[model samples]
Target: MRFMKSFFLTTFNNHLIAYPTPINIHYAWSFGFLSLMCLTLQTVTGIFLAMHYTPHIALAFSSVEHTMRDVNFGWLTRYTHANGASMFFMVAYIHIFRGLYFGSYTKPKQWVWLVGIFIFTLMIMTAFMGYVLPWGQMSLWGATVMTNLVSALPMIGDYMVFWLWGGFSVDNATLNRFFSLHYTLPFVITATSLVHITLTHQEGSGNPLGIDSYSDKVNLYPYFVVKDTYGLFIFTFLFSVFLFFYPNLLGHSDNYVEANPMVTPNHIVPEWYFLPFYAILRSVPHKLWGVIAMLSSIIILSFIPWLHSTETRSSRFRPIYKIFYWTLVFCCLLLGWIGGMPVEEPYITMGQVLSVYYFSYFLTTLPMLGTVENNLMNYFNK
Candidate 1:
């Protein structure tokens, strides 16, 4: 027993507790831990919800309604799972934005950042699939609408759509596949998260000052571990507020109605987390280009580490980057606002323009800044 304790201590102490980390990292650092906690909450709650859920089109909506009305504490479980998803995305976006502002995606940590992006992509897929399992009006039509995007793929469009739907439309087979994938992907995400955390541990944490931590390293135990715990508590309190008080606040009213093939909602808005990308999709005039642009919005993010180059690591040190960094942030928030609005007139025009600025910031602004900044840094050093 003593030997086993020693072995456990050695592994954890060396790999995690004794791991050297930047001392000055602020509350932003805590969001990573908060995100993991949210995912955990989601997974547990989802498992319970799934046990009672029926993936069949005929039974799916009624099954969820039964779970809410009949099973002991079913409403609580359902609300927790639904709200937990929102909280997870909320925590994740904050984590991503924080990394972006501090240049955490730069060299050495690029692979780690990539892992983070992969996890985010998996989360999105998992969420989209899970949304369909409830089998509501929004679920049926949303699946049909989104899957129909494949029809824009030129000659092979119908074939792809047939495969995606398992037939001509969103039916039983589609729901079954969605449930299977939705139930499975969270565990995959959890496993990927372990890799992400391991890579993060190898490099230690980055900071706002953006300097190397070797000069002022501190162990993860007591300080960082405790700090992360406190952060989790804060997140939990806020999450509980949503679960208990306002369960449907983030959900669309259209989703509560049973799906009807002939009926369509006046407006088909996605969940809040996906709104920005949805806006981007509608921004383009053409179908294929719209899908490409929407996808590029996310795919482009992974290339950011290579897209920009500079000697300095943090935006705090780069005056020009700091300005554009905030511009990117504002653009994302504006896109979210535009996403929730009807895609007509002034809103459509505004979305298209914002989409242009969004891509330019990544393609044009960052690369040019990197070249200019690298030269400026070199001239000063000499």
Candidate 2:
């Protein structure tokens, strides 16, 4: 009873009590709160989808269409879940870029950001698997091509592919397992989110200036809660617009057809969020190198804290670094665009250039910029 009272009081004080937050936080910080609201939206809609969705390979596609054609409010549920995935990714990218811009990944709480990256990776895997459950033509071959990438691994690659497929190719077992895992992984993401939030709380939120443990620190309650609540309402409004008006905007027309393994899609592209890595995969003539590079791009992000050397907290103070950082952002956007195009000569060439910039920005430029800034600061001090 004592513990329960303490818990209740703590919750009330943290959420209800008006508190000041770092005034330096910009609207970019709103993205994380918006993401939380999206998670709530996705979860509610996803549960509704599960009730109507048939996970069986033979019935899954039919089940989706049935929900659309027959079930009351089923179309809204389905579209909300589908487009919610896109919206979740869209918000997540902005949240991540916000972290990058503010240098939020550096310092005493770098682990929090790293865990967020892992969540992002898991989210991608979950989305990829979920995309296959509709059992459309693209879904069928998309699963096939994607799962086959594991075969590029060393000795056990072929074995892993067969294990994932439960056979020589993607079939009933694959769909069933994907359905099971898709349902399971989001909860894992939620758990990781708890850890992410805890870590951030322990470190306390970073400011635009990148300073830590400043005396001017404010309580996180009323200030952020109000801002976050407002952000959530705005996100919900946008989500509702998609839910009602442009439900199919993020989905593929090819997905309306049932899974036909024999007939391949003319352009077998994954969703737009995945295009950059997919482009990386297709850019290479060899499957193995492409797979390696694709996975490396995400893993490399974990090493960023170590890659950068400067002691400063914010880019506002590091003018030269800010220029290169924005350039990297542009390069990433360019890479995403190229990922959707056919791997013709010019397209492939452009992808290669962007990919190089992507790696160079992290590995070479970040380190050099940090060192240069340190030297300048030392000279000024003298």
Candidate 3:
């Protein structure tokens, strides 16, 4: 035990003494630490909820209610776990945006950022499937509708949907499988977290300068560790408040009731985190095309490193990159907003336009910016 303690202490000391990090990382950088804090909170609260959660369809709904009303602090467990999902997504989005703003996805750390994106995608899947476990109206139909999307494929799509459901429809087998996957995916994500952190330490954190091995870089300890701790405190404070008081704030009222296959939800919006990509799916006029576009939106994010061309790390020095960056951000927001509205001709048209811009930003605009910036830099040098 002494040896273990000493090893940790020494490791902490080494990281603390490493270097001086840039002071310009901004509040955006706080999100990564906040996300870590949120993960812990979610894990703890989730474990408690699991103790009272019933996996069987017959008892799952009542089991949740039992915990909420009967078990000691069961309500707290329920609310915290539910609300924490929202908090997790909130911090994750900020983390991803911070990476984008600082070019943290560039070489050396590309795999780290890619892992982060993978975690993000997995998180969405986990949350989506987990939300269905309560056996609520939205939970049932939402699972049904979303899973049925897999059937949109030509040959394997129907088979895939059937496989996911474990039956012809969203029934007992489906719940059991979703529950199993939901329980398992977090561990997978935890492993991915290790990869993310290892890669992060290898490349070191991206400073506001976005350059590698710059004199401005700082050690992970006293500086960021301290700053990260502060963010954790803030996150903890808010999370505690939710756990104690407003735990259900992030959940839908319909989820409290048992799932009724006969009753379809009027407006079945998935949890907020899935809104943007879900919107992208709803935007397409063609069934297959919608699925393709929605999936492309996610997979395309990984290609950003190859696409973005500016020689500089930070967008601060690249005027064109900054323009394109903000444009992409706006387009994403637009896509998200359109995703919630009723599917219509105009909305579909708008989604297509934004989708075009979205891909263009990756495939065309970023490359163009790099080339244009290179030319300008050369001209100035000459």
TM-score of each: 0.96, 0.95, 0.92
Compared with the true structure, what per-residue lDDT tens digits does model 1 show for residues 18-135?
8888888989989999988888888999999998999999999999999999999999999999888999999999999999888899888999999999999999999998888888
- Top lDDT: which candidate number? 1
Clashing pairs in 3: 19-219, 20-217, 20-218, 21-217, 21-218, 279-339
User: Once model 1 is optimally superposed onto the true structure by TM-score, how far is the C-alpha of residue 309 displaced, in angstroms?
Assistant: 1.8
lDDT for position 329 in model 3: 85
Instruction: Give RMSD to native, each candidate.
Output: 1.8, 1.8, 2.4
- How many clashing pairs per prediction, in order? 0, 1, 6
Pick by TM-score: 1 or 3, better one: 1
Compose the digit string of candidate 3's lDDT tens values, residues 154-265: 9899899989988899888988888888888888888888788767766777777776656655565567777777877877888788777776676778887788877777
Task: List the candidate 3 regions with Cα displacement exceeding 4 Å.
Answer: 1-12, 15-24, 237-249
- Native-to-model Cα distance after best TM-score fit, residue 338 in candidate 1, in Å: 1.0
Kindly report which residue pairs in candidate 1 clash with one another: none
Q: Which tens-of-lDDT digit does each residue in 247-306 have in candidate 2? A: 877778898888887899887878888987876676667889989888888888899888
Q: Positional deviation of 216 in candidate 2, in angstroms?
A: 2.2
lDDT score at residue 298, model 3, on the 0-100 scale: 89
